[model samples]
Target: MGRAPCCDKANVKKGPWSPEEDSRLKDFIEKYGTGGNWIALPQKAGLKRCGKSCRLRWLNYLRPNIKHGDFSDDEDKIICSLFASIGSRWSIIAAQLPGRTDNDIKNYWNTKLKKKLMGMIPSTHRKPPPFPTIPLRTTPPPPSSSLSSLYNDCSPYYTSTNSLTGLESISAAPHNFLNTSTTTSLAINCSLLQTQDILLSPLQYYPVKDSLIMFGGDQASCSSSDGSCSQISYGKEIKQEDMGLHQSHMISNGFEENQRFMFDYGHNGSDHSLNTWSSTDLKPNGYLGNTALEYDLEEVKQLISSSSNGCNSFFFNDESKTQERALYY
Candidate 1:
């Protein structure tokens, strides 16, 4: 069966309402409400207009207290906010603003408010994010060419969206980059940092002999005032001694047999929140003498298979970091 008629379109008049038609429709609705059925109202009121046309004219214009045009600032803000949240649900948006009609709002947004919103283009794409900003405290020598090449390549590692606690926090490099663990990995390369008393170091680290370098710990961290004190700051360089470990020290710590393997962080840098991590001494390879570190500067990338059922972390998210940042470069 075809759709039932709401009214006889053949019998209904269409086009702009004249004064006489408006008067009659207004009088009928005031004396007797729509009686719960718009489809039959026009015929009962003896108008040559469709029930929809009568309903629209009455509700959009003739109805008592119906507001037309001249949207205020508060109203515009409401429109923009709701548009962002719910997206173009005009009728719902209309309900939030007293006396505003959905049709009026829909038209105003399309015709005028949309243009005003476009002018705020610069307001949207905020500060560069997902990385910490570094302050220029002292100019250390440029990072070594190999370390520079690693950053340029972005790899030899897993990227956990985890905000880095330290280069020292890395558990260990996978046997290769293809490890199926969801754990995020970061690869660290050392250059050097010159010491300043006032500056709080973001991280001070030494390249591990054959393991992922750990940050925020004594084992992986370069100590201040020691001859091997160095740092690996974000996008910057600091020279650090390799664990201050002499062959005797490495042997004593039982580290010689497993020269390269997983790094176990005994810390999350929580203790260093005071930010006093800095070193005054600059030694090329710490007490290891002329022994060079076996290092790779490639960042390893891996796809995250699933998100966590993890608890709330103390680490900063991307948005908060952006807001708190003073400068990115």
Candidate 2:
């Protein structure tokens, strides 16, 4: 069967939008709100256009209150928090940022921010996602041997464990780590040593390992200071790492067994809400580490109010404010 014609494509005015059409749509919405009935909107707005077209033009381009210009630092926080809360649902996030659109934001995220984040992650951690293709080879390698070798190539051999009861709480609900409020990008890689999984040394407070050595993305910029692990903020290296793992003996001697992988939190140096709740170190605000324990929406409202004035507003709650202050120094 042939495909049906589009509602707006038949005997309809199309192509470059005229100023009259723009004015009609704007004035109609201003006077009587976006009625959500696009099919009827063009007639009401007195424009020779389809409802879908009007909706797209207004939502993606001409919304009056839309914030246009480079995204601000605070907007970055909102993006991170949204990513942590809901992975890649850019449309939902755009709803929160008044004037933004899902398409524009999604493009910026994939191109610019994603590149910077991939830099902080290790090379080994990111495996090229599998692509689908039917093999035409007359005689394929034995399935078992091929599968075993692949495992040997990308086996996860290292796992980092943190003892804070709070991490235990956070990990308990693996879903909560991606809560609506925090912005954290998690990428981990484990390089194989002869012994298999390497137990991370608790001796170091924080550790950064390079993981992306195979495909030649970004390397070297993925180290961490053991000291800052105690804080919410994580750090990165100044330059990219050298990519020498491709043909090194590390892969030849069946010693591909000795190769290393990368892991990353993609955590920029933002002060996370305190998670520490121990009586001994608990601040007046009752936080555990950087996660907030008790706070109110009014405080959030207050911070949001302050942010409008082009100021650096702390987290909406008192405990968050304290951590933000400490982060300044």
Error (Å) of candidate 2 at residue 245 is 44
Worst 10 residues of 2 by lDDT: 219-228
lDDT of every model, 2 decimals: 0.38, 0.36
What are the runs in model 1 whose C-alpha is more than 4 Å off?
Answer: 120-329
Separate clash counts for every candidate: 22, 31
For model 1, residues 1-329, the per-residue Cα lDDT tens digits are: 99987778888899999999988988888878788777788888889988788878876667665677698755665564344322354655565555666678878876655534432122347654344333321433233323223222332121222221212212222332213222221222211101100011222333433323333222211111111122211221212222222223333442222222111121122231121111211132211112233232211110000101121111123442331121110
lDDT, candidate 2, 1-329, per-residue tens: 97765455665677878877878778888778667577777888787787677777776666554456677544544453343323354554554454566666777666544332222222456653343222222443332222112222222221113212112212222342233133332222111110121111111122233321111011111111111111122233322211122212322332222111222122323342222112344333222222111212222223334443444233223333332222211
Mark the 10 consecutive residues where model 1 has the least summed lDDT: 299-308
